[model samples]
Target: MAAFTAADVKALREKTGAGMMDAKKALDEANGDMEAAIDALRAKGLATAQKKSSRTAAEGLIGLAVEGTRGVAVEVNSETDFVAKNDKFQDFVRKTTQVALGLGNDDVEALKGSAYPDGGTVTDKLTENVATIGENQQVRRMKTVSVGQGAVVAYMHNAVSPEAQDLGKIGVLVALEGDANADVLAALGRDIAQHAAAMFPLALNADGLDADVIERERKIAAEKAAESGKPENVQEKMVEGAVKKYAKENALLSQIFVKDGKATVEEYVARIAKEAGASIKLVDYVRFQLGEGIEKEESDFAAEVAAAVAG
Candidate 1:
């Protein structure tokens, strides 16, 4: 006996989303070592894939910038939302995004090594901000999109400051390729970027969507169809139909335009192209939602207060 208790199993379950029995088995196998138990569960693929380190237990702003046909979006995270709203933090995010635009690369590590406008490298400036602001901060990620001919439009949802609408919780960049008039292309790009921010499309089109995501959707559809007790042929058809619907809903070009709800994004682009007298194609897009896919640690204020009073 490795001296493990029931509480250990419970904690393991909570941390890994594993079944009670599985957690118990893992703990027993690890001989009461919590870390080893977690590793065992992960090795067996029985635990959630999320790494403890990757959990973005922070709040911050998504910064976006567009210069002519090029645009960049960067997510800078802080330990608290209070720091996210700080003017200095916001300025850092904005300046970092501008620097990212110049780099024209998506590598955050490389961006950190790049120079900051004031003087030192971006990493050095960030370290200075962390020391002065009294909070742990990081430049989490960056993405850039561009078009050789048309325009790259940026949109920010729930903008922190109306005066400078480049910083927000959700940032989007849409690249439109065409030879249309600059004004017309800009207007159209704005509308499309707005739509992208609202709809949160997974990819530009069905063909571009990740194969793993498509397969996962198919599996879910197959399970649902099985539950219906239908014939084998009918079940197959049902799964296919469900997958097509999923693609239409999740793919950007196939999704219905959020602004009008009357036409697909592709159709909307065609309509705009007809009006502008130039062929416009949506080349690419990037959407960054702050803290997306990162689980935050939950705190119990009441329990903390009780414990403090008891102490």
Candidate 2:
């Protein structure tokens, strides 16, 4: 019989985006336990997503570097965005991305263990940088894509630094594999990269999407179909049809072309191939939106000010 306070209900409402009364009821159902309340909401299908904590709070730069047929994008996060604008910090991100490109390694620990120009390991240099810059920083993640004969074009959205070097807050890498002119392929790749940044497609193809994600969508669609009071056999067919539609909508190749909106992405690529006089295959793509999946710590600025004054 734990009593849930108004503040507790408000906090739960903010976190789960449920109404205040719903939040209070949820808290009461969980006996005033926040984590349990989150789980309870999930059990009742009230939450659109599961809460994930323990992600990095650090924020800095997402670097994109393309050389020859390969490109790499790495995220180096600091404690503040101000440090992301620092010249030294930008240089670190640029150089680290270059290092990542050559290493052909995706493991953060392995990249850190690799050599750096200034003597010690990459991790060691990063540590030295933290002390020198007076801000805590780390290489959060890296991804690489390459094509043997095609082009890997890159684009930086909202670039705030040098053109030839650092891109911006959002970085995209698109690899086009084909026999077309490298220049033409590069242009097409850039267009696709920009599309990726805007579209956020789930996968390159139907098979690439996570099984769990597909099943989750399947369950939801099946439940909706069942509500029609249709026969179970007919409902199964409806669910299957709905799943196919979901796959096409979420898959990159089946998605409508963002450039024209009249054709699918596959059709757009086919048009590009016809125009370029060669068959173009989108081998892979990487899109990093500054903090798409990361949750930031929400603080009460007014309360902090009052506490400082009291101190």
Candidate 3:
């Protein structure tokens, strides 16, 4: 019998970021000694997994899965675009998105805990994948959108290559709610989703914009207005006006639809609604632009040369 329990293996894996099987094997070899197992992993260089996990994983595909009225978008990031192109990595992302779609909501922690289609949990699989692929990967975020009565459409933008189907750097889902024709709803949602993919709307509506984002815009507007030698009252009005304009430009509903450049997104939806013969509402949406906020580390050649010389 193995001397270590599954919890011991899990702890070791968490501490060292080693894969489940390797952690268990190390624990067994160390006769259930946590410290000894960690040492063993360190000697094998697998203990560096924890450090690798901290590296920016800003290059990967956005995995998307849509089923009828519901759709899920998952962002699985890797250390390099080369890894993103790996079949195993792509397969892992695709399976992860499928698992997330089954979860019915966008809880990333729960998704990680959920069982993978393979023999182990999603986290276990991810850890093993990282070890085998020799690169750190992260299942960062997932969003699930559904409509009570309508259709949710999906669009993937800028597929890495011709072979990369149904996966892209940007994945968008648009849920349109109404009892209108499903086909019509799907068509309209696809159009909207494509627009979202191109335009990169920050939120569904002006009010949905983040407070921090709005505040940042306000600060910029105030500074610019002050530079105009404007009075306090005018500056205050200018700030509000600029903030409103920012919100309008960044929100999906108020932004001009890119397809024709004439109608606002909401207006485009209303025009489609007339064809559908019912009221249509874009109730929810999710846009997963890969690595949107992650700051990738730039390799410093001078520092590398200095460190090498020191070594």
Candidate 4:
């Protein structure tokens, strides 16, 4: 009997981009171990690296606020896109974000407990919204970035709609520190923010990348290297090279700027700094793509169709 269920096969297929049969076969080989099956698919070059932000199932909006050198990003989640487009829901996110910005903190629980603009705590307002909108809502997370000497620029990619200004699917904040003019810093910061939205870098630099992520890449690279039929030393070099390449690509500063393609993001920033006659540093950034890291529920299309036909 097959050890994995049909749903397991479906999930494996979604995660690895493998065909249904391939996912099922891989899962069977691994005795229903999802991670092991994923590795098997990648070892055979049938699957790509795991996208950390794989599922976009959580419907929500990202609220952004920038006050001079300080900026904040707040993610408020709802159950459906219908609720996301609702005016009341968007207003809750916008007001919550402003409250967070005023708090100048990164604590979601604190922001939830803080007073809302409409004479209630943020959490009170959220509960009210959920009841009034007839959908579950949550203040998932928030982050703030600031630079004393420079600028904290903001960018929203694919705003929920034209009406949802300062709220979007992807919100980015970039903090640059330097003595450059405000206009120069704002321009450069916004360009970097836009790049961040497109690139979706995992960390500010290669060294800041998560150790678990690096180790997983190493394991996958080693498995692929073993297939080369090369000497042990060559295999070691290949594995290290692959790991380094993965880190370089995932790290924000080491990535090639999406704008020019030729220049690395670090080099691009440096070039701008030189032009502005200041030593600008990319201090920090936040790239909040809606529904990141959320495991969304899935349905069986076959079952649903069968049920509808029977009905």
Best by lDDT: 3
Number of the top-ranking candidate, with TM-score as the measure = 3
Off by over 4 Å in 1: 1-56, 302-311
TM-score of 4: 0.77
How would you encode candidate 2's per-residue C-alpha lDDT over 172-209 as one tens digit per residue? 88888899997788788878877887888888899998
TM-score, model 3 to reference: 0.82
Candidate 2 regions off by >4 Å?
1-55, 162-165, 302-311
TM of each candidate vs. truth = 0.79, 0.76, 0.82, 0.77
> In model 2, what lDDT does residue 81 have?
86
Model 2 C-alpha RMSD to native:
15.6
Which residue window of length 10 is worst by lDDT in model 1? Answer: 46-55
> Candidate 3: where is the Cα deviation over 4 Å?
1-46, 161-164, 301-311
Point out the worst 10-residue segment of candidate 3 by lDDT. 42-51
lDDT of 3 by residue, 1-311 (tens): 87889999999987766788889999999999999998787666544556688888999899989887889999999998998988888989999999999999879999999999996899888877776576889999999999889888988888766766568898888999988887788788889988998888999998899999888988899899999997899989989999998999999999999997999999989988897679899888999999999999999979999997999
- Displacement of the residue 45 alpha carbon in candidate 4, Å: 50
Arrange candidates, best lDDT first: 3, 1, 4, 2
Output the lDDT of residue 195, model 2: 83
RMSD of each: 14.0, 15.6, 7.2, 16.7
Whole-model lDDT values for every prediction: 0.86, 0.79, 0.88, 0.85
> Which pairs clash in the backbone of model 4?
none
What is the number of residue pairs that collide in model 1?
A: 0
- The 10 consecutive residues of candidate 4 with the worst lDDT sum are 46-55
